[model samples]
Structure formats: C-alpha cells, structure tokens
Target: MNGILIIAHAPLASALRQCALHVFPDAGSALAALDVEAHTPPEQTLEQARQLQQQLGMPHTLVLADLFGATPSNVAAKLVDGIHSRLLTGVNLPMLMRAICYRHESLESLVSRAMMGATQGVVSVAATAPQNQSRRTSHDQDQHDHQQ
Candidate 1:
C-alpha cells in the first residue's frame, strides 16, 4: 500500500485527521489499509515522513503542508531532493480529504488533484446558486401559506 503523510506545525495535522475521520467514519480502516499516516508533533512529523517514504520503498511521497515558508513546509522542503516528495502549501480540509482518497496516484498526479480540489472548495455560494432576477416581497410566503 502506498503511503500519504501530512506534515503540519502543531495541531493542524491531528485536527485534519479528526475531520477526515468525522467525514469518513470508515477512513481509519481504509487509511490503515492504504498505509496513510496522519501525524503531528514538533519532534516526529518530518522524521515520520522520511521514514514512511523509505518504508514504502517508493522514491517519492506526497506531502501536504499547511503553509508555505513555515516550519512544516520547510521540513517538507528538505525532503524534496532526497525522497522525491512534493510539498503543497495552503493545505486545507478539501486538499487533505482529496489526498487521502487518491493516495494511490503518482506524486505529481496526487499533488495536482489535491490542489484542484482545494481550489474548487473555496467557491462562493452566491456564484453557485442560480440567479433569480424576479424579486418577491415578504407577502409571497404569507399568501402561499394562507391559501394552503
């Protein structure tokens, strides 16, 4: 099974893991089967990312980071050359969820898809909703309810 490792400064990684679990209740089992590791802590996160790559026997690992130029992103940057990992910044729930579901993909492909998911997730609701140019007064609801 291929592995997906998330590296964030302090609580972001764990918080994302919890959110993923809440979104997909069966993810624990699925994640275990896919060798996904969602870890956080000042000491072990980067090391775990490195070790997971080696253990998975893959030259590359897909690393999703919370912010660019931050500790987590910096740590992930260090592994780029050695482990063939791709570091994606601005990591969010959509990105993490997308990454977990598509962990089997190649590093490049996974990064691309995760980024797309993140971008799409940040849409405005008004833009998505159909525009109703015809304005209705407050009495509209009252009139329908009275007739019923």
Candidate 2:
C-alpha cells in the first residue's frame, strides 16, 4: 500500500485522524503527524517523512497539509526534490479520508482525487438544496419542526 503523510498546523493532525477514523474506521494504517505548533520542528518532520517513505517501500508519499505556505507545507516542499511525494494544502477530513481510501493509487491519481474531494467537501447548504422551490420549502419546514 502507498504511504500517506499528514502534516497539519497547530496539532490538528490528531483531530484530523480521529475524523478520518470516524469515516473510514479501518484507516489506521497510514503515517501522520500534527506539527503546526513547532513541536517536532520542520526539519524533523521532513526527515521523518522521508524515513517513512523509505521504510514503507512506497514509490511515492502523499502529504496532506493544513495550510499553504505554512511551516509544514514548506518542510514538505523541501523533500520534494529528493523523494517522490506530492504536497497538498488546505487539507480537511474529506480530503484525508479520500487519500487514505485511495492510498494504493498512483501518486498523480491520488493527488487529483484528493483535490476533488477537498473541493467537493466545501459546499453551501443552499447549494445542496433541491432546485424545486416546493422541495426547498418542505426541507426548511422539516428543519423547523426538528428544532421545535
């Protein structure tokens, strides 16, 4: 199986993993860490990721990061030249779950799927509503009844 590296900002990795577990349950297989607070240091994260890639014998590593241009992302960037890894920014539960589910996929394909999952995860409730006005009204009524 391909390896997954989750590097998030501010210790959010643990929570992200929990969310992933909630979605996938059996997804406790990949490697991940939360280093947004500078606990592990960027250099250490890079080394660890590289070591994990080597140990897992995966052709490529998929790194899901919390923010773009942040420390975790930058650290991942440094390893790009030496390892077959893809760095994705703005990672969320949907993206992580998707990556883990498709971990065995090629690096390029996994990255594309991850991006799509991330994009689709972000949606306005109104946008998800039925196009028919009556359906929307009924939906709103149901929501109101549930609140009462």
Output candidate 1 Cα RMSD.
8.1
lDDT string for model 2 (12-112, tens) is 87788777777777756565554556667677777876775566556678877888898878877776653478788899888887888788788888889
Q: lDDT (CA) for every model shown?
A: 0.64, 0.73
Task: Find the number of clashing residue pairs for candidate 2.
Answer: 2
Please give, for residues 58-82, the per-residue lDDT of candidate 1 as tens digits.
5456666777886677777776663
Q: Show model 2 residue runs off by greater than 4 Å.
A: 52-57, 127-148
Give TM per candidate: 0.63, 0.73
Candidate 1 wrongly placed segments (more than 4 Å):
25-45, 52-59, 127-148
Give the best candidate by lDDT.
2
